[model samples]
Target: MSDAPHSGVRFRGVIDLDEHKVHDRPTIYVYEAPVRAWHWTNALAITVLAVTGYFIGSPPPALAGEASAHFLFGYIRFIHFAAAYILAVGFLVRIYWGFVGNSHSRQIFYLPVWERTWWAGVVHEALWYLFLRKEPKKYVGHNPLAQTAMFFMFTLFTLFMIITGFALYSEGAGIDSWQAKLFGWVFNLFPNSMTVHTLHHYGMWVIIIFAMLHIYAAIREDIMSRQTMISTMISGERQFRDDRED
Candidate 1:
């Protein structure tokens, strides 16, 4: 196929491009170490908070032994309080990391509301979830709907729970304490401390619902979308099934 004399190079050769099938590509480094650490740490803290917080709201049947000696209820409260503090501190550290870490680290913190393409992605994701779309798009970070849910359902609700929780703690710590100094303003909005307590309780349900969806989506997308999901958070690397750019 070449015009040049004595050249051994073949100008071209034809091959079926479709003959090759690729199941993976070079992995993208997405979540950083701090972000991944905070993710699992926050998950554990959330699980403990939800379970113990539920019991704090609804007590189990009394123990057979003397109530004076047993501290089962006290233990539950301690665990719940400890987990809440862990979650709050983790969230704060995550926020700081968002500013200093990789761009993917900040995906869950904000929405691109002004972008029409982002809106299209939201609709596309919604349709995919409903089984109306045949194929799902690949993303190194969260898809649009997941990002929205994270910002509203997880992030805001986590902040609400922290503030209200500390305000409730301020009652025992007294109005003069540091907890009150920081979160006492939350009382001004609710007026009744019990009202804040109830709202905080409801926030737990919202977080639980979001968590279920997050888990289901991760597992589903890992199988159906041909991209790594659950493992991405664990190893901070995102892999796609194809070389095609998103």
Candidate 2:
């Protein structure tokens, strides 16, 4: 019995010769193009809103002897409102996609109230990241945790923006304007619109924190799993292990 014959029988692929190359096999596309486009567009809009919002919320020390320089504040307000409109459009499109899009993008599947398996999914996902398990539970789209976060934050922030935005706009429209009347209930509850405005300003920090965490998680997954997690939000394709089909 020759050793050469035994070696030929035992050989697999490049992995059989190299231990370090023992990684998961690659899978096909995961995210779609629309989802990616929505992500980046929303990101840009949010960035603009944050920068302009800071100026709109608190004016800097006035430049000496330039009374007309107050237009800087006016421009900040204009950009903030403009970005808000763009963000609102992106938000509406995402909602519509959640209905007509693929199974992963479907609103019913992502909504916490509707997804029966979401609780288990959350636990499994957490364990997956914590390294408690060798193989992670797979989802074709947003994981349970992400689905819940996006839904809650998007809904609450949109309402907050609308209520506070309308309240502010109503000031210039006069108390009798329809805008004022429509938001009259919110103002009545708060009594001081400035307080509501302050809350709205503070809400940006919450969104920023969420964005930071989201980006970090995406990058971490990409590096660890060899998945194109971040690029999927731009190029709309995620490569995963072939065995990890969801």
The per-residue C-alpha lDDT of model 1 at residue 172 equals: 83
In TM-score terms, candidate 1 sits at 0.88
TM-score of 2: 0.77
Q: Per-residue lDDT of 156-201 in model 1, one digit per residue for the tens?
A: 8888889899999898889999999999999889899889889989
Q: In candidate 2, residue 188 scores what lDDT?
A: 77
Q: What does the lDDT come to for candidate 2?
A: 0.69
Q: lDDT score of model 1?
A: 0.85
Task: Show where candidate 2 strays beyond 4 Å.
Answer: 1-31, 107-110, 113-116, 176-178, 181-184, 244-246
Clashes of each: 0, 0
lDDT tens per residue, model 2, 134-209: 6555555777766777666755666577677777777877899987998767777788888888887877877777
